[model samples]
Target: MGGFELTLDTLRDLAEGAAVLGTGGGGDPYVGRLLVEQQLRAGRAVRIIGVDELPDDALVLPCALMGAPTVFHEKLPGAAGIVTALRTLEDRLGRRAAATMPIECGGFNSMIPLVLGAETGLPVVDADGMGRAFPELQMETFAVMGVPGSPMSIASDHGDAGIIDAVDNRRMEMLARAVTVQMGGSAYICDYPMDAREVRRTAVPGTLTLAARIGATLRQARDDHRDPFAALTAMLADTIYSHGVVLFRGKVADIERRTVAGFARGRVRLTAMDDPGDQMEIVFQNEHLVARRNGQPAAIVPDLICTLNSETGAPVTTEALTYGQRLTVYAISTPRIMRSPEALACFGPAGFGLDDPYVPVEQLVGGP
Candidate 1:
């Protein structure tokens, strides 16, 4: 599909797909769904355009909610906050955005751009920086491809806002994160303002549509009484992701999570539903970073590690994971663009303070 209008009929699919891509991070997709639905009900429109459809020099500003997902559950970002930040960035650059795009294809971040599109009457790009979510602001394909995150703007629902101009993307993350904390743990941001030419080369292509497909696939499978996991893996085999595997099926045994450093940092332990001795542990910083099963790495960063409800095939975000929840943890390989040397250096295991080297999820999991 080249482009399409987002209507109330398709909004749920996009939200569900985004939550799966979130990989147990990003904010709550259900909350995001409600937010976007609210806009559609208000008679606004969200038009999504594919990467190839973008004009070469048209300005495309990426926007998202940056903060702890746990905090987001208690507070919702207002449409005005997002618009305020986008306008701030636009004012600094002296260019009105031809389109808005998602920084990541996860939960609230994915839908926030759609909300912006509906609110401002600008088309939302059907692509994103990280094909999935990552905690740090600089951990995006845009930054890896040399797009600076500066001239970034942050705004809160209460009307507070500021722009950050930093020498490097990392410094930009630090400064913006500090501002996010002051704004009460969560805030909306517009950053990496680049023309469509840069976006076509740097962003993960067609992820918004891909996310919608994922959501639709799960829904269809469930409606048909088919195995949603099997259906999901089969569908992913045909995408840029290439491979998907159900790494483990278990119940949440323990969870130790905390909001720290402007991120939801923690680890969750799960025990096999049938085998008490078989266990797995997944760690995260706003996003699932790694998964280890029986003391061996099952999935590592740069790949997608996600948790889904065992029965409904619905994704469960990190903030919502709780003890005794039955879940099917799965991993999908990221596209080659995300595995380049520079990309790995930005979001690889080392980036999250892990000693293990980056490993493709298929190699680690013995995929279907």
Candidate 2:
């Protein structure tokens, strides 16, 4: 992404790619994509940099949208929610942001920072706290490296702002989630506050650039009538599960939901496309937790479970699941950063209230 001049086309490509990497979580990037497009249209300047370019003492934080994916469908967040959080965080930290970074690789969070950076003239860092998406604040590369998750600043659309300082990331997830739910199911979080030194050591390098590249690749492939699934597979180590249906064709057969101590937890079941005799189940705790065929687990926690529109192969979020429609269920292994004990400890099945064995997804999938 060298010395690139910002443009709407570029942001659109980035958003599309982020959607692919979102792996069925991070909410839809459509609104965020449009939001960034508007900023680019307004002639904003945005710079993207590799984390390697960061100063040793810099305070780099990863921030993103957080809330019930359900509410996201009903009340589209006022697009400025992210910038609001950045401003609120700066006010409390008593410092200007040196660089802005994405908390995860999903479309919305990854692209939102570009617009914020454009407006603030802060360079968007190339790396992210997570190379892929995870359900909770505690389940990031920063956590794997032992950087604390709190002293995080959260901002809401109602002009409400506060600092989240917790005993740990789990506590932070719980506390921030409580406040965010009260604030209307979602808010922005600036967390994993780290100096440039830690950022260099822990963060996934070139994730932002990688996101743009992925977006571009997908777009190019589609235009050329190439297989997007093949391109996606080459881009990351993930599995693709699909039929031929588009986004609007899927049906939600069953949903089992529960709120355990503030975290939204549940599973959704869908009957097969052509045969009701077959079935699929998607488990989630804030994000897609697991997927299964018949009674055997097909995809599990720590493994990416992205539901793609069958025709397009784009990622799908839990919030988007519906009844009886055909859909592609992808299962990608967790990024290396998320495979660590600490990362898994926070988001593994146990964290989501399951007693299943904690096994690396690769181990479960065998090879290729």
Best by lDDT: 1
Which ten contiguous residues of candidate 1 have the minimum total lDDT? 359-368
TM-score for each model: 0.98, 0.87
Error of 1 at 253 (Å): 0.9
Q: Tell me the deviation in Å of residue 340 in model 1.
A: 0.5
lDDT of all the models against the reference? 0.90, 0.70
What is candidate 1's CA lDDT for residue 3?
A: 88
Model 2 CA lDDT for position 202: 86
C-alpha lDDT of candidate 2 relative to the true structure:
0.70
Give me the runs in candidate 2 sitting further than 4 Å from their true place: 1-6, 79-81, 237-265, 272-276, 366-368
**Residue 139 error for model 2, in Å?**
1.7
Clashes of each: 0, 11
Write one digit per residue (lDDT tens) for candidate 1, span 1-368.
47898877688998999999999999877877787899989888789998678779999999998999999878877788899999989999988999999999977799889888888999999889999999888999999999999989999989888889999999999998898999999899999999999998899988998899899999999999999989999999889998999999999999999999899999999999889899999999888998999889999988989999999889998889999999999898999999999999999987888999998988776767
In model 2, the Cα lDDT at residue 157 comes to: 80
| Cα displacement (Å) at residue 360, model 1 | 0.5
